[model samples]
Target: MFEKILIANRGEIACRIIRTAKQLGIATVAVYSDADANSQHVKQADEAIYIGESPASQSYLQMDRIIQAALDTGAQAIHPGYGFLSENDQFALACEKNNIVFIGPPVAAILAMGLKATSKALMEKAGVPLTPGYHGTNQDADFLKQQADGIGYPVLIKASAGGGGKGMRLVERGADFLGALSSCKNEAKSSFGNDEVLVERYVMNPRHIEVQVFGDSHGNYVHLFERDCSVQRRHQKVLEEAPAPQMAEAKLEVMRQAAIDAARAVNYVGAGTVEFIVEQDGTSYFMEMNTRLQVEHPVTEMITGQDLVEWQLRVAFGEPLPKLQHELHIHGHAIEARVYAEEPEKGYLPAIGKISYLHYPEQNQNVRVDSGIVDGDEITTYYDPMIAKLIVWGKNREAALVQMHHALGHFHVEGLGNNIAFLDRIIRCDSFKHARLDTNLIQREDEFLFKNIQKANAQLIISAAFTALLSLFKQNITANNPVWQAESLWRLNISNSYPIKFKLDDENILVNFSPVEHGFIAEYQGQNYQVSGTLIDQNSIHIEIDGKKDKLAFSQNETALTLFSNAQNFKFAYIRPDFNTDDSDSNDHNLKAPMPGVITKVLVSANDHVKKDDVLLTLEAMKIEYSIRAPQDGIIAAAYFQVGDQVKAGDELVEFQVLAEDVA
Candidate 1:
């Protein structure tokens, strides 16, 4: 066992590794970038070292700095949790050269599985079932198009060295192949510095099931069962569950054995995952192997009751497998939802801002939250936008779904956009509840998942009004004053009516509140309701409206007030009647950056004519590329930013002069 280990990663994974290290009586060292100087992982580690600037290229990906940090801290082993240098073969080799243990698979295993093309070829040789497509190494665009044409339409062009949904595109027709191929290769070059790509048949309605396989240097290997990661958006996983619902025991054993064979073929050591795309008929095809701990590994942990990080440490220390295949069994069903700080309604664009208020569900044996952020921490464009992961376990899949829905409902985030409500909808939706899942589940269930089932009705209006008034009253109360003085507003015999206005999305709401004896009468939409509210805590309010009681979680900032009820979040902006709110000068003809990012491509110049839907520029943020398009046929009046320019949300990227006849 290592006396001390250094985690060459940040955020929740790094923090997660440290907790297990501490439990094992091993001191842990944390490496941080400028952005994560005061992050939760930094505060939790036994020792901390500054690595470099905020950008991952200058920090986490700087293998030398991370290795040096491990050496300086006297760390016997370095754990590269998940991203960054986790699967980089050179990093593993470098650790071996420095006599420091890399708590992961051998460099040989990493090299074998590093590229999708090579890994698929190797898997085929190992007798693992593979998808029917081209995995050969011809990088020519015409050659790739021909392969795609032969494979049929709707082929997936994936970056050979990609993971995390980057550098991948789906072309539905031969005409669109070249363009999609170009974008895919550009992203691959930008993200992995490898432009090589492979064409695969895009499996429709496929379920992404991956087996968790672990091996020790002693030639011992075991599979920890599987996780279904089919619920996805933008080819990225949103929800994952263990023991994959509806899989037969016989079929599972075959996949598990295949996974073990994959590990054995590479002489793999430490933790790795073999992913497969499962069809509706139960047939499965080999995807790629991830040679590190996955983001959703907690789901497996909950079901197996084993600390995978601890296993990694033991394996790296040359210990034998902790448990044989027969000894390990699944205890229950577990599911994990990735809570991201992004707007689901706005094409899931990453949101950046300080977390003014953050509340997670109370964790117990049934619910767990893994996060590396606290209140006042900012979500920046420099890193992934995942705020936390909420994992829940239950005796069965249905029970787990129920737990996850409730857990997601209890989550509240303010000061930026988030996907808490979206996640809840996913768990509660009929398709997910019935176990009808696929990689395109999100798209198929889009209407229900993004539905506005609940709105600001009279009950909600009264609750919001009473809570707002009580919050103000509590703020005005002081230690030197009697509480009755603060309560005098209700004591007055006269009914003083206060008119409050709020904006929910695009709808405007008006409510009138009049003081009464025990509560206030709220008039909304020409209906009156008696309302009273008590502050349970800073983030919660217990309210009664018209003899019915409800408890709501709420958070307020300078601009918006948010309320969470019935598994949905309603964010309302206060409409001050006295303020002049005219947007006559605001130009709809101008194209603006939807979020903060760095401009990577400027496809249009000033005075250039462009059709509607033409790509004007491309911005890269949080490792995702977003194309800014012309909203209408117009002539570009000005292109404000060039390639490589940094932009903030709503910064004008291009000004357009639209045809006057088309304006109306």
Candidate 2:
């Protein structure tokens, strides 16, 4: 084994590799960007090195700096975990030239399958099932449009060099192909610095299934079953699981063999994944191969009872395959849900902020959480916004699905919006449970997944009220005098009751509280309930509401109060009745950046007329582009931001002037 290994990535994957390296008695070195100075991955490594600025291009993507760090730390091998340079063939070759072992595939294998169009052609020649479309080298726009026309409408234009849905666009008709193709090329150029693209038929209701394949330098290979990654949004996976549900044995073996063949075709070494698009009729087509450790590899680990990182390390050390194909067997079913710092209601735009309080569920044999985040960590806009992955195992698929829902429900995060509730709802939905999954599951089950979770749950609704009151009481408390803490907040001597205004989302709630001998009485919406509570622990509150005992997990910050209970998380914000927010606001015609990001495009200049929903400017953050649009028909009065300008959330981007008649 190597004496030291440098992790060429950050976040949970880096932490995961560090754990395995420590067990193997190998020292681990972590390379971090400026934004990750105090990150959890940095703290976990045996040694840490600063690379460059926060943006990946200046830091993580600096191949030379990363290589130098490995050499400086005496790291014999560098593990590129999943993203960033994990699949960059140049980085792999650079490592080889530097005489530092790259814990990944050989350069030949990477080159063979690096670009989508080239790989698709290779697969087609190798007789690997491929989607019927254009995967040619011609980059001419008109030529690509003609190809799309031949492939029929609903064609997908995708970046030929990168994955994760970057530079991908779906065109519904020939007339819209040019616009979609242009946007896709721009995104591809911005994201991967490559404008080349490929066209494919957009198969509706397709499920994404990938087989895990590993190879050795000695030409040995095996397939470790498969994972279903169909539940997605914006063409990115939200949840994944091993032993794809509803998969038949014959079809599994066929796909497994195809994956092994794909690896063999590239002379692939170490761990890799061969993805496919599965149709409803049991047919599958080759997608692409990921050349490094995957984000959802834990589910495979949970089911196979093996550490994939250990395998990666052993393989990179020139060791033979850990076990032959016949020696491995699936022990149980496993599922993983990716929790991200995003708001699903807001088009799943990434939410960036300091994490006030973070807690995953109590982990055990059946439940596991892999995260490189702590309570005070920051989710900056410099990189991917994934917070953590929740993995669960069970004896069967049904049981695993149940465990996933339970795990996601217990996962709590605050100070930034997250998709925990959205994930929980997804796993619990009837279609998901019945195994009716596809890439469109989120869309098909939108009504149920996005429904108000607190509407029918009286306990959760009341808990939100209790949380708001207790938060206010605690803020008034101090170490100066313990008695003044509760007394100053309640004012029981002078006033028995007071109206406290609060808000949940857009609803304004008026909660009336009055002091009682043993506890307090609170009323809302013409309903009264007796409430008494004392914090049992830092995150749990022991409360008796109307003589009913309940314990709720709680946390608070300056602006919002949160409570987790009954498999639900409720956040309530205190509203000040004295402040008239509408009176102080300026005209509503102005455009604002929805979140902090760097401006990438300015579609309109001052005095330019635009219709409602016209894209005025584009902002890029968290590796995704957000379009700021005109709220109403208006003329641009002033453009405050230009391309490449860094903007904070809600920062003014373009001020507009709307005529009263036009606005009406």
Best by lDDT: 1
TM-score of 2: 0.94
Assess candidate 1 and give its TM-score to the true structure.
0.96
Clashing pairs in 2: none
Best of the candidates, TM-score: 1
Q: Give residue 228's error in model 1 in angstroms.
A: 0.2
Residue-wise lDDT of candidate 2 within 1-664, one digit each (tens)?
Answer: 8999999999999999999999999999999999999888899999999999999899999999999999998999999999899988899999999999999999988887889998988888777999989999999999999999999989899999879978889899899999998999999998888999999999988999999999998889998899999999999999899889898889988899999999998889999999999998769999999988888899899999988999999999999999999999998899999999999978998998999998889899999999999888999989888999999999999899778877776788988889888888888888888889899999999889886564525555566666666655653222332323475543545765657665776788777777666666778788888877766556777777789887677787666678776456677777755665576578676678788999999999988988889999999988888888888887888999889999998888888888679857
TM-score of every model versus the real structure: 0.96, 0.94
Q: Give stretches of model 1 more than 4 Å off.
A: 475-485, 488-494, 506-508, 577-585
RMSD of each: 2.5, 3.1
